[model samples]
Target: MQAFDNNLTSVIKSLKSSYGLAFFNNLTLQLHQLINADYTFIAKIDKERYISQTISLVAKGKIGDNFEYSLNDTPCADVSDDSVCIYPERICQLYPNDQLLIDMKIEGYLGTPLHDSNGEVIGLIVALYESTIINSEKIVALFELFSGRISAEIEREDKEKKLTELNLSLEDKVNERTTELSSALDRLRFTQDKLIEQEKMASLGNLVAGVAHEINTPLGVAVLCGSNIEDALEKLNSKVKSNSLKKSELEHLISILNQSEKSLSFNLTRAANLVDNFKEMAVGINTDDLMSINVHLWLNSLIGSLRPMLHKKSITIELLVDKNPPNFITCPAKMSQVITNIISNSAAHAFEANDDISDHQVIISAKVCSDILSIKISDNGKGMTDEVKDNIFEPFYTTKRGEGGTGLGLSIVHNLIINNLSGKLEVESTVGQGTSFNLEFPSLI
Candidate 1:
C-alpha cells in the first residue's frame, strides 16, 4: 500500500501542472517511463464499429503520432470488454491476426479498461514491451490509479459542449421574440394615429352641428316676425281701400309695424353674430393664427355660442371679467377651442346628479396680472376624485367611457393650450364639491 501511494502521488504530480490534451500526453509519457515499456498508448473505443482510436501514443520515451485501428484480435479488445488483460510474453503468438503487434516486435502486453463515472467501459490504457513485462503488478497498480482522471476530463468536455449549444439556442429564441414585439408595436402606433384623426374630424362635425342648432332659435323668431308684418300690411291695405282707417287705428298699425321691424332686425343680427363667432372659433383651428382680442367681449361671444348646449340641459353659463380688462394676444382659434372644450366638458360631465337647476351653473372669468392672463372655468356640480384629476390632461382619458364620450375633448384642450397656444392649464376638484380649470397664458403671446 505504501509503494502504491508513493507511485500515485508521483504520477499525479507529473501531470498536475498541465491541462486537457497536454495533461493526457504528459501522463502517457510519464507512464511509459515509469514502467520502462517500449510502447505506451491511450485509446477510446467506438462501440458501434468495434474500433479503437489512440488519443496519446509513446514509443521508447518519445511521443509519436496517434492512429486508429480495429480492436478485433488485439489485446485491447479484451480490455474494452471491461477486462484487465495481460500476456507475459509472445503476445503476437497468442493472436496472429494482430498485425500491429507483430510489426512492432512486441512480446508482452498489459492493458486495463477505463470506466466513466457510471462505470461503463469507455476506453483503455496499454503498455507493451519487447521482453516479458517485468513487475506486471506494479504497472497494473499505476494504470488503475489514474484511469479516473482521464475519464473526468472527457465528461467535463461533454458538459461544456452541451452548455454552449443551449446558450446559442436561447439567444436565437430571444432575438426572434424581440423582432415580433417590434413589429406589433409599429402596427399599434399606426392604428392609434388613424383613430385620433377620425375623432378630430368627428369633433369638427359636432362643432358645426352645435352652431346650426343654436342658430335655429333666432332664425325661427325672424321668420315669425316677417309673417306678422305681412299680416299687418294685408289688414292695412283693406282698411285703406275702404277709406275707413281711423287715426288711432292707423297709429296702432304704425306701432305694430315698427315693433315687428325692430324685432326682425334684432333676431337677424343675432343669427349673423352667432355665425361670425362660429367661424372665428373653428377657422384656423389647426394653425397658429395668433392675434389680439378684447378679453371680455371674446369670452361673452364664445359663451353665447355654447349657450344652446347648456340651455338644452337647463345649465346656465356666465362670463365674469373686469369692466376695463386689457387686450390679450393669443391664437384666437386655439383659445376658443380650449374654452369651448372645457365648457362642453362641464356641461356633459358636471351637473349630472344634481336635481336643482339653480346649482347647475358654470362661471368663466378672465383677468391679467403682471402680463400673465389667467382664465378660470368652474362648475357647481359633481367634481372628480384625485386619481381622475391627476390623469385628466392625458390623451383619451375620461370617466365617461361608453356613452358617446370620445375622451378626447379635454386632451385636445390640453394640447391646444400647451403645444399650439404656448400656455399652461391646471385643474382643481373634489369628488362632490365641483371642478375648476385655470388656463394661463402670457398676455403678449
Candidate 2:
C-alpha cells in the first residue's frame, strides 16, 4: 500500500512537469512498475473509426513505442463503452480468435474507460500480464485514479492547440483590414485634390464672365460716341466746301462736338478702369503676392468687381467701413477669392423675385477691433434651416444641387480663410429673417 501511494504521488508530480505524449509515457511506466505487470499502456480510442492508437506502452521492463490497430475483436472495444473489463486467468478462453491476446499470451487483463472533461469515453487504460493476476481490484482502483489525470492532460493539450490556431486567424484578419483601409484612404485623397482644382477653375471662369459683362456697356457707349463725332465732321466739311457757313450753325456744330467728345472720354475712361480692376483680380488669383493695403479700400474694390454679377439679379450691396481701419499685410488675391465665393453664394441662394421689396440687399461691414479684422456679410434673403447651416461648409453638400451648383463655393471659402489666412469663420441665420457670415483674422500690419 505504501508503494502504491508513492507511485501515485510520483505520477501526479510528473503530470505537472511534463505534457502530452511525454506525460502519458511517464505515467504508463510508473503504473507498470507499481502493478508489476508484463505490459501496461494507454490507448486513445476512435469509436467512429473503430480504431485505437497506443499512445504509451511499456513491455517486460522495456519501454514500448506508440502504434495503432483496429479495435475489432479487442478487449479495449468493450472498455470504451463506459465499463470496466477485467479478465483474471482468461488465457484466450473467452475469445479464442483474438489475435492480439493470443500473440501477447495474456492470462490476465484489466482496463477501465478514460473519460474526457464532459464525462464521455475517449480511451482506456489497460494492464496485461502473461500469468493469472492476484489483487486485480487494487490494480483496477489505481488505474482509475491515474486515468482521470491523463484525461485532463489530453483536454489541456487540445485547448492549447485550438487557441493557437485562433490567434493566428485573428492576426491575418487584422492585417487584411488594415491594408484595405490604407487603399481606401489613398483613393479618397486623390478625389479630394481633383475636386479642389475643379472648384478653382470654376471661380476663374465666373470672374472672366463678370468682367466681360461690365466692360461691354462702356465699350458700346464709346463706339456710339465716336460714330456721332465722325458724322459732325463730315457736315462741317460740306459747309466749308459750300462757303456758306453761318455763325449760329458753327456754334451749334461746336456744341454738338463738345458733348460727343465728353461722352467718348468718360466711357473710354470707364472701360480702362474696368480693365485695370480685372487685371488686378486676375493677377491676384494666379499669384500669392502679399502686400500691405487698406482693408476698407481693398474690400470695396473687390465688391465693385463682383457688382456686375449681382446687379443683373437686382441685388444691392452696401459697404460700411470703420472710421480708422488698419492696413493688413496678407495675400489679397486669396482674400478676394474668399469674399467673391461668399457673396456669390448669397446671390444665388438668398433671394426670390418679389415686387414688394425694392432691394435684395447684401451689407458688407468691416471693422478693426483689438488688432483683429472683422468683416460681416449679411443678406436679407430667404435664410437657411438649422440642418443646412450646419452642413453648409461641408464639401459637396449644397442646397442647390443639379442647378449648376457645384457645392464647393463655401467649402473653398472655409479652407482659404482657415488654412491660408489662419482665420475663423462663423455663421448666424434664421429661417425667414436672414443670414450673416462673420469673418475674423489677425491683422499682420
Per-model C-alpha RMSD: 5.9, 4.8
Tens-place lDDT per residue, model 1, 1-445, is 5865686578788777777678889899988877889999988888999999988999889999999999899889889999998787989999899999999899999998888899988889999999997788878877888889887776676678798998999988999999999999899778767766666666566567778887898999999999999998998999999999999989998898999999999999999988887776777766777777778777876776677778766888878899778777788777877787788888888876445545688998889778788999999878898888888877778788888676777877887788776788889898777899988998545
TM-score of model 2 relative to the true fold?
Answer: 0.75
- Please give the CA lDDT of all the candidate structures: 0.83, 0.84
TM-score of 1: 0.70
* Model 2 per-residue lDDT tens digits across residues 240-359: 999988899889988989999999999999989878866666675857787776787677667877887788779999999975576777777888888888888878888866534456
Name every residue pair that clashes in candidate 2. Answer: none
Which candidate has the top score in lDDT? 2
Which regions of candidate 2 deviate over 4 angstroms? 13-29, 32-111, 126-138, 223-269, 284-288, 294-297, 322-326, 354-358, 368-371, 385-388, 394-397, 400-408
Clashing pairs counted in every model: 0, 0
Model 2, residue 118: displacement in angstroms?
3.9
TM-score of each: 0.70, 0.75
Candidate 2 lDDT at 169 equals: 93
